[model samples]
Target: MFSLRARDAMSASWAVSLLSKSLTGFSFWIVGTGAASAHVKWFCAYDAAGQPRGLENVLCRDFELLLGVALLWFFSGCVVERTSLGELLVRSINRVTEGLRLHTEVMIRAVCGFFFISLWAVGGIILTPELKTTSPQVGLLQLAIAAGLLSRRTMPFSAAGIVVLFGLAVRDYGTFHLADYPIFLGLAAYLALTGLQKDLFGVPPLDVVRYATAVTLMWASVEKWAYPEWSFPLLIEHPGITLGFDNEFYMRAAGMVEFTLAFALAWTPLVRRVAAAMLLGMFISACFEFGWLDVIGHSGIIVVLVAILADDRPREAEYRAPWLAPAGLCAALTVTLFTYYVGHAAMFNTSIL
Candidate 1:
């Protein structure tokens, strides 16, 4: 059960099962920790039956210190090259990146996924209060843990991992609004589908990542339709303000368009470009409505968009570029305000009340 065979069909099945078990174990640990943290201080007794046996506390602290040290060692190597610490590092990365094999790419994704999972774990520990009170969110946490474990070779797992991480981070920062979850879910779907598919000469193998993205986009569209409040007003909002929709019909029409496009994105890869474009529009609109200026999160999605574009490169093209990754990101930041007023027409209209 522990062995990984390169050829056997059972191997995939077994791996998924084991991965599920591992995820469940981590989920239970997180839930238990969250529950315990709610009542007691970090180093104090967790229950009436338990004593202030500082041994467990000390051991946990020591373990954390060691883990930090080990992570630094591994990450520093990824950052630093052998002889060149300046321009050479950039050139070296670019040169080597031109020929990255599928396995190597998967490994890189796994490393990134692990880093994200670690962040979620730490964040959850800190945000125990919010999680303890709102139990449904724990399902998202569990889903993330499971996805991280299953990300071995499948795109679905990768999608799950990315979405779960986003979910955890959003919740930690107190962004539990319903609209935000779907956006994050959409992003997670994009990441998972694109991350696993390393080869894209033609119609790239529609694996888990693609499937996940399709599911999320379609589901989100369905949800938006079901909850007109989240979709309608924003569609016909004022250009630069959060004034909400003056006309209900305009908002509803906009919702229909968003819903339709989201579904279209699922059925065909060509629609991904359209989806990316729409999302970019929405991001820009968001900036106008609320000067959030959270470039980090915003840029992350843009990176994925750029990655998708890069992946769609033609085989005949000469010297394909990877810098498009950062270019899309910078461009998105500049245009983020465009998406701000999407539902602006509905923001301040109290007449409906």
Candidate 2:
């Protein structure tokens, strides 16, 4: 009794119903089979205690305490600057440091080539979260840049391009947020500057690389103390990495080890090579447990650390450190880390003691 059009509509509806059911079954199969696993995180953990997290906010409870301790550390630095011991230590360090060699145009070009590969092909394989969503845009630009930067003459354009990307990252992720991973952006911009002229605004590029790496280490290390539970899964999976210690002790010791290395990296180039070597080992060790994403997450740092090793500049000047400089540094580290652990614990209801 139905017309031909009515018969056709009923048949089409039946097909759609079958297709929908099939997709739902496939989704269940994919999830239930352990096909899609979790990734190592790029973002720092948030403070979700009370209020809602708005998109624009950079200050979670943990970072706010981080800022407070930093202010105290800065104040301590100001006090130390006025001491004769500080000047003595500085001169000693200046002498001991194998100050960076001025790069030849050839060397700068080489570094750019590696960075270009990092951005284009490797990045094409797996884009880092830090790269924003514009991989194609960034990759094509890097291709042109590598050609231009073959000599030091075209550095200005590279610098400008880096600046634009820096701005984009800041716009997307607030500059102050730890989760934003701002150090890489800062380092990329600084590396661009290093290619332009004799010195990086009177500072060495290696120094910036080391210092930036140190900052990143210290920043992330605190999270381990603050939210040790986040690392609980790793402990569960690989108990051997704990090396026979109880889990709680292992976490605290691990956090301290990271903090100490980071603190050492910033204190003196005297001990930096040792610290960098240790950090490199730790990064590689972490890669075994977390998988390739850990390596990708830290690749930028690994490149810079390698460059730090390749630097063989010798130092002619050395200074004697009065007892005060080392004492002050030790004191600063102790206070900052102690407060960092307790502050985070207080904020998030984790135990510090």
Query: Model 1, range 146-173, lDDT digits (tens) per residue?
Result: 3654444555575565555555656555
lDDT of each: 0.36, 0.51
Residue runs of model 2 more than 4 Å from their true location after superposition: 1-40, 43-127, 130-149, 178-182, 316-328, 331-353
Candidate 1 local lDDT, residue 297: 26
Choose the strongest candidate by TM-score. Answer: 2
TM-score result, candidate 1 = 0.35
lDDT of 2 by residue, 33-95 (tens): 110111224433334232222212323433333333333443344445437865664455444
List where candidate 1 sits over 4 angstroms from the true fold.
1-207, 230-247, 267-271, 287-303, 313-353
Model 2 / residue 4 / CA error / Å:
98
Candidate 2 lDDT trough over 10 residues, lowest sum: 29-38
lDDT, residue 61, model 1: 33
